[model samples]
Target: MKGGPVLILGATSGMAREIARSFAACGHPIQLAARNVARLEDDRADLETRHGVAVTLHEFDALDLASHKGFVEGLPALPDIAVCAVGAMGTQEENAANPEKGAMVMRANFEGPASILGHLANAMEARGSGTLVGISSVAGDRGRASNYVYGSAKAGFTAFLSGLRNRLAKTGVHVLTVKPGFVATAMTEGMDLPEKLTADPKEVGHAIRIAVQSQKNVIYIRPVWRLIMAIIKAIPEPIFKKTEI
Candidate 1:
C-alpha cells in the first residue's frame, strides 16, 4: 500500500533531493519546501516523471522563524512523514573568526530546524500520528576542536530531538534522529573525507527511508559512526582537549 504524503524541508540540498526520490519511488506523493521554489521545478518534474507520483513545491526559509507556523499551517495536509534536511556546515576557521558567521551556522543548524520541527510535532501530536525525521550530525555526539561551532549546534538539535521523542512517546507521534557521519555532497566537495567513513547521498537517503519505516528512534547512517562516536565520547576531556583530531 502507498504511504501518506511526505514533506521534505530544505528540499534543494542533494541529500534532501535524494530522500525525496526515495519516497517518490515508493509511490508517496512529495511536497518539497525550500527557499527557492523555482529551482525545484526540475526536481519536481523529474520525480513525477520517474516515479509517476505527484510532486509539489513550496518556498521555505529556515532562518525565517516567524514563518514556520504559517508554513506548517499552509501545507495542503499534514504529512505522514516530515523530514528536516536543513543544515549548513560553515568552515571551522571561518566560523571561529567571525562571530556573525558562527551565529549564522548556529541558527541554521539548530534554531531553524528545531523551530520547524517543533511546529510539525505539535500538529502531528494533535493528529496522533506521523513521523518526524531530523538529520543531525555525528559531530554532535562530542564536540571536537576541528568543528566545535557546528558540532555544538548539532548537539543542541540532537538533544531537542531526544526530548521531543520523550515527550511524544505516548502521543502516537514518532520522532527520528539521523546522524549521517560524513556524506559526500556538494557541501563537502572540497573536504578530505575518508572514503570508508563517507557515504553518498543515495546511501544516506535509502537508510533514512528504512529507518523511518522501521520506526527507529535514532540511527547512525554508518554503524561504525556509533562506535567511533562512542570511543570519542568515552575519552577523558582533559586528554582529549590536548589532542588534535
Candidate 2:
C-alpha cells in the first residue's frame, strides 16, 4: 500500500540506505536525515530517479540533542512513518578502558536515539497518526561479556521503545522494535558472523517494510536470532559468566 512520506534518520548507514530503498520502491516519498547533508546527494538522486519518488535530504545530528526539536520542526511535513537507525557499536575492551568512549557509545545507541524519537513520538501523537520504527539489536536481549557496553545501550533503547509503544497504543501511533542479530553491513564488515545467522542489509530492509505494513510490535530480522537470543537469555548467570560467547 502506498503511504505518505517516510523519514529515515541516520540515512547514510548501509542498513538505512536499504530501508529507504525498500520504502521508496513501495511508492513512499522518502526524507533522508543525517549529520552530513551533502553526503546524501547521490542517494537522493538515485532514489528519485530509480523509484520516481520525491526524496529530500536534511541535516541531523543524533548527539546534538539541542537541535532535535528544531530539526523536526523544520521538516517540510510531519512524516507518516519515522525510522531511527542511529547507533554506535564500539569495541567492548575500548569502551571498558575509556569511560568517555563508553559514555559516547551509550549516548549514541540509547540517549541520542531515544531523545530524537521521543520528539518524533510527541509530534506523531499530537497529529494522532504515525508509525515509529526503532532498529535495535538482539545484543540487548542478553548482555554478553564480550559486548556488554554496546549491548547495555541497546537494552535501554529496547525498553524505551517498549514504553513508548505502550503509551501510544491508544493514540494511533504504532511503535515497532526491530532486533537484528548479525546484519552484514559496514558496521560488521570485518567480523566473522555466522553464515546461518547473518542477514543482508536488503533482507532487513524488506523485513522492516513488511513489519510496518503488518503493524508488528517487535521482530527479529532473522527468526533464528529469536531462538538464539532466548537460549542465551535462559542460561544460568553463574554458568553464562564463566564462558565467552
Once all C-alphas are superposed, what RMSD does model 2 give against the true structure? 0.7
* Per-model RMSD to reference: 0.7, 0.7
Per-candidate Cα lDDT values, in order, are 0.95, 0.95
Clashes of 1: 0
By summed lDDT, the worst window of 10 consecutive residues in model 1 runs over 1-10
lDDT value, candidate 2, whole model? 0.95
Alpha carbon lDDT of residue 79, candidate 2?
Answer: 98
Cα-based RMSD of candidate 1: 0.7
**Minimal lDDT window, size 10, model 2:** 139-148
lDDT of 1 by residue, 66-161 (tens): 999999999998999999999999899999999899999999999999999999999999999999999999989989989999999999999999
User: How well does candidate 1 match the true structure in TM-score terms?
Assistant: 0.99
lDDT tens digits, residue span 1-245, model 2? 57799999999999999999999999999999998799999999989999999999999999999999999999999999999999988788999999799999999999999999999999999999999999999989988888889999999999999999999999999999999889999899799988989999999999999999999999999898888888999999999999799
Give the runs in model 2 whose Cα sits over 4 Å from its true position: none
